[model samples]
Target: MMKTTKRSDRIDLRIDPKAKETIQAAALLRHKTISEFILENAMGAANEILAERRHFHLDAKQWEAFQAALDAPPRPLPRLERLMQEPGMFDGPEQEA
Candidate 1:
């Protein structure tokens, strides 16, 4: 099977002259093009925004519980061995003749 790659659509955004100059200076200092600098910063901002949206926001007690779980000792159950060897529940029911 073949897969198709996605391409970016052209976008135009306006910024102040000072901001553009600052970006150009930074890009030059880093030996990157303005587009590369903008895309890098945009991707970082997108990741932060997306992570914020997808993560759970915990309160003090919940945070303590989460931390406690992380610090707690691991326990093993005998049933886990049986479960690990068995076919998954998702395998579905038997087929009829």
Candidate 2:
């Protein structure tokens, strides 16, 4: 599939002049525009943050257990079902303090 690199938004940041100069130097060293350098590095860090948030690295035994849990049929818990049927914290009452 063809991809587009059309930037249709803006993000303005205020930073120390020293930080800006440092970024400028880094960008020059990498032979990339300031925007490209920032986006590439920032996106790399962003991807790490998101991957850490969303993906798990399970060992073989843990993976087996995880798969088993997913494949198992639902178990009934009468207490839990009843608890859910009860009025929720915000519903139908003003509890005394």
Per-model CA lDDT versus the true structure: 0.90, 0.94
Per-residue lDDT over 1-97 for candidate 2, one digit per residue giving the tens place of the 0 to 100 score: 9897879998888999999999999999999999999989999999999999899899999999999999999999999999998989779786798
TM-score of decoy 2: 0.67
- Model number with the top lDDT: 2
Query: lDDT by residue for model 1 over 11-70, one digit each (tens)?
Result: 787999999999999999999999888988899999999999899889999999999999
Per-prediction RMSD in angstroms? 11.0, 6.1
Relative to the unseen true structure, what is the C-alpha lDDT of residue 58 in candidate 2, on a scale of 0 to 100?
Answer: 97
lDDT of 2: 0.94
TM-score of each: 0.51, 0.67
User: Residue 2 in model 2: shift from native, Å?
Assistant: 8.9
Clashes (backbone N, CA, C under 3 Å), per candidate, total: 0, 0
Ten residues in sequence with the least summed lDDT for candidate 1: 4-13
What is the Å distance of residue 51 in model 2 from its true position?
2.2
